[model samples]
Target: MKFLDHPSRNLFFTGKGGVGKTSVACATAVKLADSGKKVLLVSTDPASNLDEVFDVSLENHPTPISAIPTLSAMNLDPEKSAAEYRERMVGPYRGLLPDAAIKSMEEQFSGSCTLEIAAFDEFSRLLGDPAVTAEFDHVIFDTAPTGHTLRLLTLPSAWDGFMSQNTTGTSCLGPLAGLQEQQKLYQQSVRALCDAATTTLVLVARTESSALREAARTSEELAELGVGNQHLVINGVFQAVDTTDPYAVALQQRGAAAIDEIPAGLNAFPQTTVPLCPGVILGIDSLRRLGTLDSAVATDVADESVSGDDELAPLSGLIDDLVAPGHGVILAMGKGGVGKTTVAAAVAVAIAQRGYDVHLSTTDPAAHLEAAMNDERLPNLSITRIDPAAETARYSEEVLSSAGANLDEQGKALLQEDLRSPCTEEIAVFRAFADAVAAGTNKFVVLDTAPTGHTVLLLVSALAYHREVTRQSSEMPEAVENLLPRLRDPDFTRVLIVTLAEATPVHEAAALQRDLRRAEIEPYAWVVNQVLSSLPLTDPLMKQRQKHEQQYLREVSQQQASRVAIIPWQLQPPTGIQGLSRLTHCDLSTSPS
Candidate 1:
């Protein structure tokens, strides 16, 4: 593959969740190291499974991989970085500040965004500072999931805007007293990212429409920022292992169809395809085995079917619980790429098929729900999308008119500046989401909420208005006033924590469940989406993968709430109404467990 052609320096791998970016990136790094080049593999993902993959623990500092002489790896520890960032921010005032004051400062910087920015700060330091890369022939970065990555990559302008405003105030992000120099470095780092010679952007996609579409969107956005030296690696490309294998034939057919419809917009980029591997691409051995894929497609596919009453039982049970008479709201809230939209659509279809009036909506700014529907005809379910840009624009106008109309030019500039933060978009979208959730009182409402970190921040921000109300003694806006009350009523809302039968997704999902409980929103059930055990497989390679999947399956069954659902792997794409119907009634138990 072209992305692997360079065994040294400047490799960037990115993709949607579950598309094998980590595996592919690791394999490339391993290949380079085995070729006698010193390779440094780093993961900026908060839920990185690098330790599991290498079968060794890693800290922020690079640890030798042991499997290869020249390869080393590190996982950027967000919590530890956040702590260091806080210490640095408040260090100068150590003698002047009280212990309680310092504690408060640390608490203020303890939010999810602070952790994210701190991680980004470390990444920029490593990537932009040549000193860090001096000892390595190659630096491979396995980025966080898509949404978080997009935000991280765009931080240069975000920090620059904050610096230009120079607002002096007590804020939610603690004392911003030490930001000036950091902001300058941040801008420089962003420039470095966009410089094609210094950076290469790789978009990883599966042979699925949604993944491809997301890649196209990512390419366009990144290109606009001048990060145009890009390559497309289509992972999980399927080819029939045997002509007589009907299941494998069906998978190849479906995969080919999806690739045929690859968005014409992404045609400009250099592209490579990876062939399907019959087994899970975990551990250095498996990755190296994949690296010898000469004249091989970069695609790796899993279309296996598993047999067990347990596999099909979970989905049926979840359906029964959701089939009550009175209408209520169902929110599929969990980590990104955990199949929330898929589960939400399936549940909405399941309930609507039972004759309930259902309205399925998504607050994801990316608009994955519309594509999930696939122009399929639905009998009773109505799909609605809350556009973040639209909501933010309207909310910004309202806030400016009501609060900053009389301000001078400098003050107005600050007002516009504060409004530009992505946090403003979150607040605006949360209000719209609240309005949509409130609409569920008389009919069934299903929401595919923003991912875990974003959702938690949104809910926490809802409580901010209450704090603002008590401090100002002013009546709050109608939208802000109604949010907290509506969300807190468990009877009115049921949250489904969706996850994949995989280590990273399930671990992140568990954390999400805890966060939701902290916010007083208990998840109704855990839906383990896309399990190989639900699908039957005759291939030995696929059978080996099933064994690997067992560990994660066990984790999901043990970690989630008592109520759980499992959707089997489908050979065909889960697009349109008929496909969704299969997911609605996913009962795969004919094969051996």
Candidate 2:
């Protein structure tokens, strides 16, 4: 509510995934509109949850929300924008180019780099072009961009360097000559971001070490980009009103300690805290009540629930199904903050317990794959991270040696500058992802992929990965050149889509499934993480939340996913091998105390 004290035309809420950016943005927009201001609430997340939060469907264009007066909202579909961008770039070549040439161009446009570039182009126009948003008094953005991507798009130096180069016929977004017209507009946008009077940036995070650290990094990066006016919103803060319940006490203490030991970088910013609530924040009424929930009395208790263990299948049911293949690739992917890393680690541990060799890895920037599982001592399982810093260094050296060896001073300087672009990191990380996939040929490779919004659309992302593999190695490695075919082959790959038992996560996971199917990859199963129905909680709010989860459980089993596995929320997060194995019911596991 304090964020409303000083209003700016543009408000940006950004942080690591699942930090309540969407909820906070929606609530702020509703409040501002209630105060009689014309507002446009926009979500640039590829996996937008505005529709779930507002209870009204929204697309790329503004749709008036019936529940809120003077407010309009839109969910920018980056995949759609990327598709349109590809058509515009390749449409002119129809009939003039051979079938193979046309296909190649299309594949290039389908790369993750194309998604990032096309997304930024749309983002710039939305912020830069005055005519496009002249109707609204304030524009609030719930952006799903990573810190790396944000730097590439908003930093003045990044654009300046790109403009100075002869980048035609080089990257995913087409010839550099085509981007000339947007330079001035981009510059204006950068100026607007830097102007404290016009824009306010809010960094959202959870009261957890990892989340706070990410917030700190983002805060530092954005400040360097000239967006100096910033506020920090630490969401999901819990306080144990029920001292008798050890679970509640432990939970509160953990959060309190995280706040007590705040990230150093965040110390400079003003901070606001939002209370943790069991009930999902959806609809106008819930949005208004967010962060205002009254503390539960120590004696408050409510018991109302419904479940059949056989009906609501546990994650253990799939052990045999998953291990049956003996060896292949198992990819765990979903929206941010959905516990994909935990689930992936659990599955790997479960499979490896069966005496098969497994390689566990991740492409996520928040590399918690190791932190999620405790027992790395298992000889059957090995873990690795495709770290951005190390990959960027290796990639930069390779590019400088091969691409810049013969360049003059100007060309060499430009090439070096280009290598520093955040997009370069995306490329380097992507190459590493490909290398990890290749490892699946010999053993069970468990991949904890990045969250949906920051990663490329699953539908087209696997395109020409095989061709790229061949290009990377003269004597191509043993890995399959065509990643999709291998993935499509039931004998070679399986994907487990992880999501929460909530409206937003369920809908997003459904969308993920649609995209994966389009890529000819079928999800072997869906893991619905964090179900309150499976636990015993003597709390009124928790009981209400349990009621809400049943609807999603039915939705998941009956409609959203063809095959499913459900993991109950633990009193504590499953952080180590023992905790993780419990989720999968692996042989080495013991039940959580």
Candidate 3:
């Protein structure tokens, strides 16, 4: 955290999910504020842990943290932010247009893009522009994961150019006056981000190969976006103080070796390393220790995990219910970095082990399916990744041939330009997902879905396409028409919301369930990955971590879902067939609560 306590007006901590972004952000903010600087910490992550970290209630505004004198914080919920932005953008048309028309217009902005734009709208005021710029000496942002943060960093220019192109008309929504002003703010935000002196983009990630690669990609993307002041903070580096424990030794070696392999793209950026503590980091005391190595590793951390052997239902239990139906779609869906691919692989492998034919596929662009399932796969199982590039190319050709076969050159050029929008990729990938779902009718299809934002957008697109067909009262394409019904059918599709045993993960998973329920899709079960409670701990720190998981484990059992499966934090990384088989045989003798 010493690398972070510098003279920057804004510092953004972003990385892959479950990589400790919130922990690092909170710890850094605490360090800076303790140095007598006025620090305003803002969390733009849809799943944020500020309240859990501070043990205090927070709103959308900067509320002074009573635990710290100079620290203030807020969580910018995307949905809430978008609703407000939508109101301001469409409020004027409310009375002018019919109620139903206004409602329809509002629905257009209710997709994931609106969430990004609205979050950016609020983000611009604090980081990009002059509003309340002087109120705090520093504004520290706890941002989302790599793909999401990268998408947002590029949004300023993307939206500005997009709005500029539509100046003449608002595409039947309304006047572009409000959006035009937003465009100017977006430009200003870009300028603020490009300036190196006042702002810094801190890439926070674990010492794993996947996390490092994602950070490097984020660094390259941010650099391409004109954000030159970048720093790579490899969080959760471990030391083998207790060399006798193979787990500790492996952890330390992995961290050290990972640092040596830093991607060339990010090698020029300054780097910070924080040693791992086995215990769960919570509240002020833990966060203070987290910011500095001296305070953190001065003494051997002791784990005071709840002195109880408690657990949830085993992963093997789901095998019975899942294998009952000879064939069905089992979808592992949740926030990014929640181990969806691994869980999907385990489920697919388990079903196949039971002599059922299972086809495992992943729609997530960042999915590591090959890593999860190695070359030595079961005879009854097969695996695939829904390649976005391949799908997009296929979709483009189909759209061009069918929709533009008779169009003139100018019209074809316009259509081609329209196909380049980000929305096109969503539709293309969604078509692939629909095809995958259709495959389940004949054989079991185990699908690992994209992150929540993208998955929700696909559902929204399906609904919109369905409505368009209904309005026209015309026949529909076979795949497009059956997409909704297939997703809505409980017997045909089993959706498992995979999550970590933590505040943000549980909250986000719950929110995901709410979103799915809105579309008439009920999750078949909840899979809690990386539970520390079930493992035997030699380190005192891990014991404390096991203690912390109790509350979340309880939350999941009593409040989150009716059927919950727990996978303990494994000593060895879950990869290949052997590692995945370990996932299905986990013990669940102890009660979760």
Candidate 4:
């Protein structure tokens, strides 16, 4: 509630996924609108669920919420934005340029870099141009998970610096054509973000160690970026009403322990705690009840038991299927905060335990593979992360030494300046991903991919690069050249879509599936992580939450996935070999203690 008090013109709600950023942002926007202030709520997340939360369809442009007359919402869809951006750049040259030239220009615009810059272009307009949002008194941004959001927030300065230093006037962003014209707008956006009076960054987090640690890191990083105006919203803080229920008591204790050992960096921010709601936050009425103590307890509801016919198989079955191939790429991918890293680690551990060579790697910027491994080493298993900074440096050196070897000092200087562009990271990371996939030829490569949006973009880039390789026999790495075909080959790669039994995660996973199928890649199976339906519970709040999870479980098993595996909620955080093994071998048909 304190985060809602005396808010700035711009409010950004961001944190680890599943931390209720969308719920809190929606509630705040509604409250502000109810106070008679015209507000615009925008979701910059590519896998946004504002439509589900608001129970209405949305578009790239603002759509007025039927429930709240003064509140309008929109999803800045990257694909659509990129299409518009491409048109703006290529439209004028339709007949002016040759057909082949036009096709080539369109191909250049199809990469992930274009998608990113296009979305940022839309974001910059909303934040930088006053006249664009003159009708609204406030603008609220419900951003993607921490890692993706940080990259987005840092782009203005990155692009500004890149453009200023580009003497050659050529780089990845050159395809946009009008990027230089938007330099002033990007500068204005950066100024608005850093101006304490104009923007307030709300760091949302769950009362869990991992989420809090991520929030603390984000706080420090944003501060270093000059976005010092910060507020903390600790969501889903729970207290057990039934002392006799061991599961409920343990849950409450875990939350309390996390709060007691709260990160020191978060102590400096203005703090607000939102109690855990008994059910999922959906619709305007439920949104209104958020942040209130009364909503923490469930109303009278039937306690229906989970049916036997709806039961899902254990994760071990999926691992059995995965390991049968001996060697291939296995990707654990889904929306953020759905235990992708944990699932990937568990799969790798299980396979390695079976005496197979396995390589566990992550493309997620915030992934903690070492912590997940818990310092326990397995002779057959290896772990690595595709660190963006290190990859960028290595990639830059390769490009400079190879391409710049024949150039003069001025040409080399220009090439180095081109490498400084933020888009270079995308190229470096893509190459790293390809190399990781290439390893699957000899060993099991389990990749914990980035969140939905970023993952989709990476795949899209693979498609773009694949096309480029076919068009001309360029110097693309063998791994990069073969990436898409390997991903599409069922015998070579298997993807497991991971999700919690919740609305947003399920819907987002479904969206991810659609994207993958479009890319000619079929998911091997779906893994439902952290299911509470099988847990024995006495607390009314816990039971209500349990009842609510059944619908999503059924949805996953009956509709979303042809094959499914379920992992029950752990009494303790699942980390290390023992905890992770429990996930792989959990018997969900029996009640979890």
Candidate 5:
């Protein structure tokens, strides 16, 4: 691969979820290790699947991959890291402080901001402190999806600016009272990332317009952050060998068109393309074969027919069940790149067409709800986004005008400084989410949430804030106070776990379901999107992929969800009212032309 030709000391793989970031990173690491270089692979994603990819158990510290002698890997498990971080921050003051004070400090550390900082602390230690990784020849980072990854990468500058400008001794970045001591380390990390000689950022994407568009946006954003040493890896570029199969031809043509219209921002970088594999990339052998032209198609085709297609229901069946609830909140959530926005929009349109008022909104930082709608409008349907920047600004203005109105200039300055902390966005977005949920009382509200990691954080924040609201009942908003109850209430909230019939997305969605069940929020259904099993295809590669998808589909229907919905792969991208309506109107037996 071009990205591996002259690898830098620090290599970061990042893009949309399910775009094969982990696969590409593992393959690159394996190739380098085979070349007699000592390598350490680290995953900073909250929902890291490095363990699954390597088929080895992982911890926060590096564990040697038994299959590869030269490679060691680790997962920066955010929950565990946050627990340790909280203990470290509060340990020194445990016996000295009163019980109430200690509890308050612990509560402060429970927010999502603390989890982010804790994870970054671990990341910074590896990148900033050279002596810590002196044994490894190369360090590869398999970062979280685009939105979360950007937030993690930009923290050094964000925190530096906040700390430098703040005259007050404290701010909302809770549990990091010793942030000043780590200032030098953060600065070093920043310098390392920006220095082209030390670090290379590989932007991974699939051969689809949406995936490529996201990659372009990420490329430009990182460039603006001074990390201009960028490379683009267009993964899953398909070429059909069977000219007669319509499905195969359509897939190839769509990919070619997406590449032909490649964004100008991504064109500036060195580019590499990895062909679509016939089967899921798992195990060390498969990882080694990745990105090689010879292994693009499977030689041994499975002649055994796939069964259990008749047991699965269509997307409209799920919509029908959801509509039975009448007016309530519907959340389409799962890993990124699994068509969550499209599913949510389709459900919203279906409901609005049923003569009910519907409001569709998104909390995902990188969501393109408008693009998904394709400028189509319904009289009963309204769409909005919980934009972090706008919400934070509005929140800050409200706080300053109400609480800072009577304060002196210095006090007001401190109040404004407190509001400028990065944690403020978390609070602002949470409130906006709660307000959006509150609207369900009058009409249907469908929310397209962020990718798995961010969605998990949002839920965790809800739990933490609920505790705070219970203790300080007088100051909390009515919407905030009622958020958890509404989420946990089965009749009020219906969550559809959206995923593709692929290894990583299916496993990640399963993990997400477990998380929700633990929080007493039951998923109403599971949506298996982009399945190819029902298509009539003669291409060996397409047939291999179809055979591979059956297991995951069976897994979802039989093991994961009580109710399951299947959406077949579409010939065209599903956008606009007409395209979206087809999702709700078509049956599983029908294939798109």
Candidate 6:
């Protein structure tokens, strides 16, 4: 609420997944609109649920909503924009090329870089072009998860550097030589982003140490880029709503302590704290009310640790099914911000502590797996990351060389242009993923996946690309060739779907499950990370909110997965090795038979 005092026209909201970026952004936008300012709210996130939040469908262009006289909203579909950009880039050479060459070119454009570039292309037009801003009093951006947003912001420089070095030529990508007008726009966009006076960067985060540290890091990066006008919003700072509830008091104390550690650098900035709400933050009404944190829930903090002698409960039961001998892989899959990486890392730590040789790895673009394992002495656990930039670059170069080695200057130019599309990264990353997944046979392989949409696409593309590769050549690399079968083998892989108890994360996790089933990958367990109900409460309102979690918790238990595990809300935020290790309770393990 204090952020209103400064009143900047350009606002950005970014945080870890499920920290309520959308809710906060929406509420702020609504509040600004209520004050009679013309507002255009844009979501650059590929996984945006702005339509759901506002209870209306939104697309690439701005849509009028609320009849609020001056307020409008838009949900930018980066995929659609990327597809359009690809077509426009490749349209010129449609008929002159061989069908095989053309198909190869299209495949090259499908990389992750292409999508990023295309999204940036659209974003640049809106942010960099002064004409676009003439119609709005304020432009608010609800960004993707932190890692993706960082990549998105850093792309201009990445593309600029790449473009500066590469000469125009045809390689594996046929018919496309290089980027044309996009380079210029990207340069301008970079300038716009770095212009501190015009663009104000708002770092939205929870009271947790990791979130705060991320905010600090982002501040430093943006400042180095010359965008120093940064503000921090510490959201969901809670206090006990019930005086009598000891559990609520303890939980509130934990949250408060976390909030107390808000770095000194951010203290000087306009800081506003929203309270923990009692119910699901869905639809406009709920979103608008999120700014006014309701202290409606409280519950007694039950001792989260299970008795070592008592019959192993459902939580331990799920882990038992998973760590059972001969299950080649245990994959952690879920929407961003649901603690998949943490859960995956914890599982690896636990397994390795038990003497299982475990390969804990991640295909997440913003992988924190290495950080998660820092200083831990789990001799049996090792970590690997499928670095998208590295793998995608290698894949692109290989494809170009193999497919278009003999093309002439013009033909190669066209091929290069065709390959410039973003779909290419998806293919490349997926290939590396396939190779990595194949390693699960001899060890307990744990995979922390990308976000919901990207992960689903990754799985689907495996089958689809395998089919394509089979058509291309009989001598496909062993990694590409074996992708589908490895994924299809249930005995070789066990999927653990992770999610928060909230509506969006839970719904998204459920959707992810549906996608996995459609792809014939059965989930091994469902982990509801950071559950507060298991903790004690003292406030009446906090107790009410905890009570409300019963329905969703029940739903998660009954409908989300046949087997489930609950991690109690910790009194301290999870960060670094010490914090992450605290998650692995020895009592959570089943006794050896």
lDDT of each: 0.70, 0.73, 0.73, 0.80, 0.80, 0.65
TM-score of each: 0.86, 0.86, 0.88, 0.91, 0.91, 0.74
lDDT of 2 by residue, 1-593 (tens): 57788888999899766677888899889889989999999887766878878889899889999977799999887778888877877788889999987887777565566676677667677677888899899999997345555555543433444544553333323344435556787677777777889888888888777778778877887787777888899898877555665555666778898899887878888888888766667788777777675522122334544563237577888878877777788889886678888888998888888899999998766678767875455888899888888988897888777767877897777667667767667656766776777777788899998424334343344444533322222233343345546667877778888988876678778888887776667788988887766665544545555676788889889987778778876767787778787787632121336
Clashing pairs for predicted structure model 3, backbone only? 279-541, 302-540, 303-540, 303-541, 305-543, 311-590
lDDT of 3 by residue, 1-593 (tens): 54665658888887877788888888889988888898999998766778878988888989999988899999888778878898998888878999987776665565555566677788888876766768788998898323443354343333444434432233211234566667667667767877888788888878877788888877776777678888888887776555665555656776778788878887888878887755567788888888466533534435544533254677887989987778879889887668888899999988999888899999766558887887668998998889887887887787788767877785565456545545456667766787888888889999987435335444556544443222212335576568778878888989999998877678888888888887778889999997767665555444555676778888888887989988876767778888898889866432222
Q: How accurate is candidate 5 locally (lDDT)?
A: 0.80
Per model, how many backbone clashes are there?
Answer: 18, 3, 6, 0, 0, 58
Model 2 TM-score, all chains together: 0.86
Please write out the lDDT profile of model 4 over residues 1-593, one tens digit for every residue. Answer: 99677989999888877789999999999999999999999997766889988999988788999888999999988788889988888889999999987876776677656676787788889999999999999999997223333354354433545434443233455442466667678678878888999999999999877789888988887787688899999999998888888778889999999899989999999999999998988899889889998879788767667552255888888887788878999999886678888899999999999999999999767667877888787998998889999998998888777777877776676567657665567677877888999999999999997334444444566545554322221267888768879988988999999998887788888988988887778899999988877777888888888888888888888898999988888887778889888887777654544
| Candidate 3 error regions (>4 Å) | 144-177, 294-311, 405-414, 451-454, 457-476, 586-593
Q: Flag regions of model 1 displaced more than 4 Å.
A: 94-112, 144-175, 291-314, 334-338, 374-380, 457-489, 534-536, 589-593
Q: Return the clash pairs for model 4, or none.
A: none
Query: How do these models rank on lDDT, best leading?
Result: 5, 4, 3, 2, 1, 6
| Model 4 lowest lDDT segment of ten | 465-474
Each prediction's RMSD over C-alphas, in Å, is: 4.3, 4.0, 4.2, 3.3, 3.2, 6.7
lDDT-wise, the better of 4 and 6 is 4
Q: Write the per-residue lDDT of candidate 6 for residues 1-593, one digit (tens) a residue.
A: 77776677777787766677788888888888888899999997656888877778898788887646677899887778878877877777789989886675676565455566677678778877778768999888887223343344443323433333333222222123445455566567667666666666778887666577667766765666566667788777766545466555666777677677867776766677787776656665665666673332333444344222122133344555567774477778876567778888887776776678888778765567766665465666778888888876786677568655876775555445544433445556666776777787777888888334444454466433443333222346786666657766777777778887676677667767876776567777788876655444445555555555666667777777777777656545455556665676523332211
